[model samples]
Target: MPTVKPRLSKQHQRWVMPTLVALVSGILMGLTVAPVEAWFLAWIALAPLWVLVLFPTQRLKLLIPLVWGIGYHGVALAWITGVHPMMWMGVPWLASIAIALFCWIAITLWGAVLVTTWAVCMTVFSRGVGTFTRVLIGVALWCGLESLWSLGPLYWSSLSYTQSPHNLVILHLGQISGSLAVTGAIVAVNGLLAEAWIRYQGSGIGNRGLGKSYKAAMRLFASSCLLFVALHLVGFGLYSRPLVQPPQAALKVGIIQGNIPNTIKLYPEGLRRAIAGYTEGYITLADRGVDAVLTPEGALPFMWSEALRTPLYSAVQQKGVTAWIGAFGEQGQSYTNSMFTLTGDGEFSRYDKVKLVPIGEYIPFEQILGGLIHRLSPLEAKQVPGSPDQVFDTPFGRAIAAICYSSAFPEQLRYQANQGGQFILSAANNAHYNPSMPAQHHAQDTMRAIESDRWAVRATNTGYSGIVDPHGKTLWISGLNTYELHAETIYRRTTQTLYVRWGDWLTPLLLGLAVVFKLTSIQASQK
Candidate 1:
């Protein structure tokens, strides 16, 4: 019989094992997004990792969180490594993996300091305080940390808000508080469970204060659960009720998914293919009696201005449906990412893309980057910024469009919606990464619809082309990689939502409350 591999000594397993586990898990997570795994939601699954760190000797306790953090970061940001090669050269996938693992390990070590502080404070405070106060304070701290993360370079895409396979009801809260609010709840639960495990483990009803801790925790959790239900139920109820009636009646829209490979998208033949694909898609929609058909960003390979005026517009005019495709136009001084709209009657209107992709679209500080910028990226000319965020006029209605990552920022979309964007149109090319990314990244836009109380029309290249309603529900979807024309009827709203005016009000308020709470705690401790 073959001998079994000997178990590693405790000293070796202490650091290497945890880091390896984290690294492997992170890579595994990067492979796909299907069968959405709530990577860090459950108390049962995560508690042991904390215990491994907590129950260890004082010297090792420091390292415990370190290892845990490596795993957390690795798995969380694993997918980002897939696109690293596209952005930077001489940077191997291993380098990205190593960098991601180390960065996460370092961040977790820092985050562990805050979490340890909370654990200590909880132990101290829980001696006399009720679980209600502890949960509230813990929730606040978690929100504060998440807010700090939002300001940093590495955004936590896997925070509690992004927890996949979670109850749809929990996701509904995003409309009221944005993604951060759900994160706050998740972090608080994690802390609460951790404290409870330390204090009242294995104790039934026999323990004296155990009953009190249980009651306080129950009340606090119940209150939070109720809040989530209220927000979700109210928002979902609106969706189930009669559909919204926009200022204008329903506008027939045709969404074209031209599955262009990354390499060819920038090539001459690729541009030719893109133009042909869009023109053909628009023609199909026009034949179907639709009013307008949409195409993804950078739709036309070359200058479509002359084409829109001549043969393109003339062909589209008779089809009875307008064509809204992303293309470029020259305004004498600079180039713009403009949307070319040819009405059925051949009336044309142009709208430039407002929010540019930071590095890909326009290098922020051109003077600073200098000639090295050209060397850094192979693109001939980094796209210049568009002058103004404009509205596209059509016989159907006024619609505003965001090019790509711009939609991820809800405030921008809300502004456009408020600026007479009866419907929000977002165009993106997700062909840059593996297919799953565009699907998930596009999912984030559903909140834009809910928060703004307007219908969102999301059209993307290579995947996740669909329509979302004001309540953040998917009405229709055309999954990635198919030669087909997809369409959806989404009702837009005339009246705007509360989130449109204020824009992420809960996050700032929560952050302010955290500051105040921390200040008060410091003062009380000093006293």
Candidate 2:
């Protein structure tokens, strides 16, 4: 006898299509960044979600966008799974899988909340508004949310990155309003498209309803087109012109990638090997006449005391060139993820890492999770955070060093730049993450270069070590999992852009304007 498939209930059928739309929207969002680098997809990526939100249907509107969030964040941040196998060493396979799933779900849900909230706001606050006003409100909501979150640690993939490594013209908009300006412009265009689609579908040519909708939609679309064109034209102008005079001189920076395995580098013998590997790389670069030599985070593999006794210290002092090496520095009972800078005079200036990775650097609620954390990992003492506004007086210029995860917060580097920082130095240990994370991370630094109008020196262990100019151009880039030494001429600038001076004040201002427009629309409808 043939078996019959179970039939879905009417309720299930109602939800299935919207769920698929959400998931598709999420996947489109992920494709906007690296590993695929289809940046243009971001322009229309939100249209599907807009279709779901703008049309009145029996399906839950908020729920659909939540699903979209899960799809988007899940794909974009899949690199978090790389830490799971390492967890397997201490926990059972099932437990490791559970841990990974928990993290993945938690982060995905957090990002999903942004999408869900935006949909709800549009559904409620967009009443009695034309397409232009509605689209402007949408832009405000997105920019406001982005500005609020960018001040903290969870500011990855702000949608502005969708233009990077491809759309340099649009990317230049970052110099004026920072990344949020670019984000607002993209969302406005998306909003106009969504409005036009809904209007065209519900009405016909030459009909009164169709004529009104067409005029409203076209007006909004024309306004959006004009704003986008103006922004790009200004961006092109800014890209061609240097906002600040070039630095009095340049730093012939040498960035070294030892390509040491994370597992091996953590062991005692691995520590010795890491030092040997880095020392050899340094000798090669120094011989080539670099003004300064840079190493990735944890290049020393030993505590500051032990590293001082080693040949790395003597070599830097003897070579008579400035050096920045990543290592651990202890003070009393705590140690920091530190960047140690040695001048030719043998004097050292230390800049400790302030923004620690959530679970990897320090477990939150340590009083409770400390035992479980210790059992599952090799960390002994929680890493100490360094003081903010700590600038290093390097021979190159007044440089600010952002270690590993600190680059996630734009404010951290911005503060340093405001305090006379000329160039930004980012040193990272990206060995534990997948390829996608490194590409995204590098894109963030490029935003920093544009926002602050400063050249960037990125030194990473295992890959993506390169130099970025003030115009957000990649001067020199490296491949992943390779042992290579690359050098580039980097300049330091003291000029600050509008974004660097005013920060993200535009977001709240836009939000206020949106609120006013909505209220005006409401009052006009009442009249």
Candidate 3:
């Protein structure tokens, strides 16, 4: 019989095919998941990417992670283009796409490196261990990523957040190790499946060992899932019990999503509508018996200052509630992105956003690039940054307020709880982020809730306006492509988790270890 031609053969097959497979699998993974059903398929989706990473070839190994990362981030985050122009209008449409794509590339490269690192480390450790221990250690290795370095900016797009809609039980476990706990399980499952496949395709000489390993891994995975489900059942029991206590002391909160188009946020006409939409939404929430209503970041078209407090304070007082609104606080030629709180009696406090978006909020290399870069690019020269480490006091309790991007960084949330913040409040404008981003963004709140053991209220303009519990479970979420209101219960959690007390100290230590290991390995190879 004639020799059969291999579908993927030689060097081209080794690198190109694996990368293509990884990318395709990544797309499938994204498609398989949604805001609510993220947890179930989290492991399955990553299996292909993990499989590519497991391949032993040097070139295929390098390209596999990079390509997989491209597909993973590119497909998952393509939704940012909708709102980029609002932040910076000078950049042409194509330039905005380029920037978004470029950012995705950076994210992808980082993800690939992380994934490759994980794969390499797992293989190195799995040499002679039983399958279950291997999986357990692998999971630890994966979860250990969250504790390694300031890693949130690189890999916080968690599988649990994607699964929040369908599996409330699964999401609740985040109370233990934060969301990264479940994320680690998901990655380990993917690792288990991918490694099993390789064993199946390999020679029979390793059959007994392979069978034992696969069997052990499956057992561990099954137990893990069952345990996760059991934990959810326990959370449900707690949730079903009397949660809205002191019913008479309820505070009405109105969260506004102005739905203002980004292109016009800075324009005079656009600013008028922006104010109208926010004020109108504020009116609606106020009339609904809200003791305090919140508008999304930069809700007002104009600058936020002690001067604008005149009308805003009067209106808030008239409404018989507090107004927590996002706007620009101007001083001289400088501007600050801020969230201002106005009480029913004209009392005021403001939390300016501290974790500013590096390029989006201000130019990083202005001295080197000169002002010409501003005209060439969409970014503004400087948007005043706020010292938002403090908590804002209200009639209820001390609430930690984190503006849009600030919420993504866990340290800010940890600091809030450490400083006696009884509750966490996040105001965002999803007009720039995709539905996926909101899903991921909202999920991060659960981790913060778990760490601090506090209730989180997330209100956004565009989509995913909702509330989360101390365990990282969502109470309610607003619908997309339309205006909606959600009345979710929230309470203060006096207790805190281990992560909260230590903050990100563990993350840096782990990252340092990984770097040292990589360096040592390089030295050994040279010898």
lDDT of 1 by residue, 92-161 (tens): 5665455444434544445445444544443343333344455565566556555665444234353443
Ten residues in sequence with the least summed lDDT for candidate 3: 372-381
Model 2 residue runs over 4 Å out of place are 1-13, 87-92, 205-210, 218-224, 242-247, 375-378
- Over the stretch 404-484, how does candidate 3's per-residue lDDT look in tens digits? 877656677777777778788888876666677777667566556655677788878777788776655677778764666
Cand. 3 Cα-lDDT: 0.62
Error of 1 at 129 (Å): 8.6
Model 1 score (lDDT): 0.58
Per-residue alpha-carbon lDDT of candidate 2 for residues 99-169, written as tens digits (9 for 90 to 100): 66766777778788888888888888886797778888888987877777665545576778878866877
Candidate 1 residue pairs that clash:
22-71, 26-75
> What TM-score against the true fold does each predicted structure earn?
0.74, 0.92, 0.79
* Model 3 TM-score, 2 decimals: 0.79
User: Highest TM-score among the candidates is held by which one?
Assistant: 2
